[model samples]
Target: MAKRIVLFMFMTFTSLVLSGCLVAESKYLKKAEEADALGREAATLQEMHRELSAENGTLKAQLSRVKEEAAVLAKEKEKLSADNRELDQVLRSKTDSLSQTVADLRQKVSDLEDENARLKEEIAAAQKAREENVRQVSKTYEDLLDSMKGEIAQGQVTISELKGKLTVNMVDAILFDSGEAEVKQGGMDVLAKMVDILKGVQDKMIRIEGHTDNVRIIGNLARRFPTNWELSAARAINVARYLQSRGIDPAVLAAVANSEYRPVATNDTGEGRAKNRRIEIVLVPRDAP
Candidate 1:
């Protein structure tokens, strides 16, 4: 609207200048009034020009403020973009760390499960071994008890079963005469029967242990025997040799002596002393050694 007014005023001023050139004398009749009117119009034009100039200045100032605000907004947008990029990087790093932690925890749980399974298998194997050992021992004890029934009833032998071992307890009088290390004929018969049963048992160890009463040797018997320890050892060795000669495996046999140290009865009485002098044939697992 301001531009149109300015253009209209400029065209009117040009027309007035041209008319003055052509009709300088034709306007003589109301020249004063006309001149006065022209003066008023010029004054109005000047006022409008001043007002337009002031408004142009105000618009210039407003344009400068708008440019400054736009520059500031551009800088703020750049800052926000940079902050978003940094936040994205941080979030990605945190996600990777959490994923790695989860993987490690899963591996730990797997290892623990594997270990638990291994322990269970070991426990099962141990239980099986114990059961097998018990079965073997029970079978050996039953055979010994059945075969030695007559001797047991006559008080010559006793059979005992405990743990994983079988023990056949025989009185010294059943194997040897007084002051003798050689086994009697009756003892050989008993040993022959025992050997028949033992040869069938392949996974057992046989040990012959001899025990003697605390009695000092005297006379020719003393010269032949020497000491109680020697007598006891000789008796055990003799029993082991006899068993080996009777087809019992020598690899499964061992001999040992206990001179008055492992007595089953008191030496204060004759009956007790006789009971204390004894022999033990032990059957144990082959792995027991």
Candidate 2:
């Protein structure tokens, strides 16, 4: 446009010069120069406008790309926020479960400790009671041993103590004669001394056990006694009856018969057979069944 305006102005000035208009030539030349200057200024302004338009277009494109990148960054930020919230919830639930488990374990450990303490106390009390019982039993054994020293020396009686019980073993010959179950005079004398000692015992049950040799019964003895079982039972009953008549408590007495099965020695020799035929008097706790 500036070039076209400049060309039209130059053609008008050339026509004026050809028509011989010398008075207007100076004015036309000045107008022509002014028009040329205006044309050059317009061309410069147009070039600046073109450059400004190009720069504006580039800026618009750069702004559009920046907007797209901002949208992507916003979406990523939202996603990361949601993920963080989920992670926090999971961590809280796990912590709560773990705390409950730890509390339950601590309660169980406390209950076990209480049970262990109770058991320890019971064990200590029982140990103390047993010690007292042992001391009492030892004293009783010493007294009986001293009282029966003479009979023990003559081999007519044997005394022993075990656990919390006292035992007095007597040969059957001194109490009976040739399968007889009745107590002899000498046996009564011996029993009188033992009964005196046993009567003083408290909380003790006196048990009389009758034992016999392995000899089988025959002839006159068989007719009266039958087997050793009946003989031993009869002997034990007679002894218990005798003790009851001599101031010993009938309620505390128990008579048991052993028919050669519970022998102290082998029954193959005379001395062994003699030893096998005996009576055992045991004193035990009244509560023992």
Candidate-wise lDDT, in order? 0.89, 0.88
Tens digits of per-residue lDDT for model 1, 1-289: 9999999998988889888866866667469789899999999999999999999999999999998999899999899999999999998999999899999999999999999899999989978977887886787778878888999999999998888778999999999988899999988988877888888775788999999999887899888778888888999999999999988889999999888898898999999999989999998877886
Report the lDDT tens digits of candidate 2 across residue range 1-289. 9889888888888877776677678789999999999999999999999999999999999999999999999999999999989989988998898899889889988998998899899889878866766676677677777777788888988988888888889999878887799999988888887777778777788999999999998989898789999888988999999999998889999999998999899999999999999989988888988
Tell me the alpha-carbon RMSD of every candidate.
12.8, 9.6
lDDT of 1: 0.89
TM-score of 2: 0.62
- Checking candidate 2 for backbone clashes, the offending pairs are none
Q: Give me the runs in candidate 1 sitting further than 4 Å from their true place.
A: 1-112
**Predicted model with the maximum lDDT:** 1
